[model samples]
Target: MTDRVAIVTGGSGGIGRAVSERLAADGISVLVTFSGGSQRADDVVTAITDAGGRAVAARADVAEPAEVNALLDVAEAEFGGVDVVVNTAGIMRLSPLAQLSLDDLDAMYRVNVRGTFVVSQAAVQRLRSGGALINFSSSVVKLALPTYSAYVAGKAAVDGITRILAQEVRGRDITVNAVAPGPTATPLFLDGKPTEVVEHLAAQAPLERLGEPKDIAEAVSFLAGPARWVNGQVVYVNGGIV
Candidate 1:
């Protein structure tokens, strides 16, 4: 995979940044795509370059098919063929099913489910032999949290897509999989949660701590690398929370 090109959406965020860095360090040319955080994305590119890894930042909303296709074209132009795609671009809204609004469901579906579909579809078009696709799910799917009904539903769709796509790409040697993280210490996790509540969550984990970004990144790296046999699965890196 030394000469492969990778596109990592939401590469500006905590988990995405870690995944991008890990892949770059593995000698892949990385295209870091961000929807809003341009500065953060550039910073991640700078860090990767400083560490003697190759990376560049691009802007795209994965929910848009045109934008996703354009991002793939850019990667191909800059680094030849696409080999891996790590999709971490997603939004979350938490509310009991009774209180959930249609707008919330729509917004989350656009970014989480539609985005994964668009990006993965585009990536498969450009993915080379032995290529890999890593999509993001969440541990909440297994845990069945009450407030995460909509968010988990979207991710559950991703899991279904991942499995089916694996079969679709069976002859191409392109593996499709999802990495589901559990209560990771990311901005998404910290958002809207009180300090006491966050602490309580850490205690609930079997590991007695929240998962780090690197924890999930490492799982992504393995699936993208030598563990090519691990396909059509959602590997959960949740500190045994479920």
Candidate 2:
């Protein structure tokens, strides 16, 4: 992936930050997009540059087409052209179906499902030949955990988009796929949970531990570059959690 350019939405923290740094380490210039955490994004870019990698941070809301397009323009202006797009921008709100708030459901839908679609739409339209578009899904969709109805529904839509988009872009030489991670040790996963709850969830996977951001990033590294034969699949990177 050397000399390639990538735009990673939600690139300030968690899996997004890991993906940005990993891609930069592989010689891919990165446009790290953040919805709010400008400092975190800048820290990622600085770390990459200090390590002799190319990266820049930009702010854009993944759900808005104009903002997404503007960030794409930034990528083009900064690194030449977009060769890869990773839609890691998402929000999670947990609630049982009967108790779930419509407002929360709408928020998740806008940022997770609609956000992925908007970013993927732009990616398919503008990404260069041999490019790759990777979206984020949750292993919880398969696990069907309680209090996750809204989040799971949104991610299921992302899975649908990933599958259909691959076929829609046939003959374009661009790959579309989604990565489903389980029990990752990111702030998003760790926040508000009791320690025992975390431990139990971690033990549900045979690996007996929470996944690190780097673990998810490794899977992304494969799909973003050399995994040409792998398309339209929701890769489960959950250490046997399924």
* 238: Cα error in model 2, Å: 0.2
Give the poorly placed runs of model 1, Cα more than 4 Å off.
none
**1-242: candidate 2 lDDT, tens digit per residue:** 37699999999899999999999988899999999858999999999999999999999988899999999999999988999999998888777899999999999999998899899999999999999999999999989789998899899999999999999999999999999999999989998889999999999989899999999999999999999999999999999987
Best by TM-score: 2
* Model 1 per-residue lDDT at 152: 91
Please give the clash total of every predicted structure, in order.
0, 0
Off by over 4 Å in 2: none
Summarize candidate 1's per-residue lDDT along 96-138 as a digit string, tens digits.
9999999999999999999999999998888899999999998
Global lDDT of each candidate = 0.92, 0.93
After TM-score superposition, the amount by which residue 105's alpha carbon in candidate 1 deviates from its true location, in angstroms, is 0.9
Q: Which candidate wins on lDDT? A: 2
Indicate the worst ten consecutive residues by lDDT in candidate 2.
1-10
TM-score of predicted model 1?
0.97
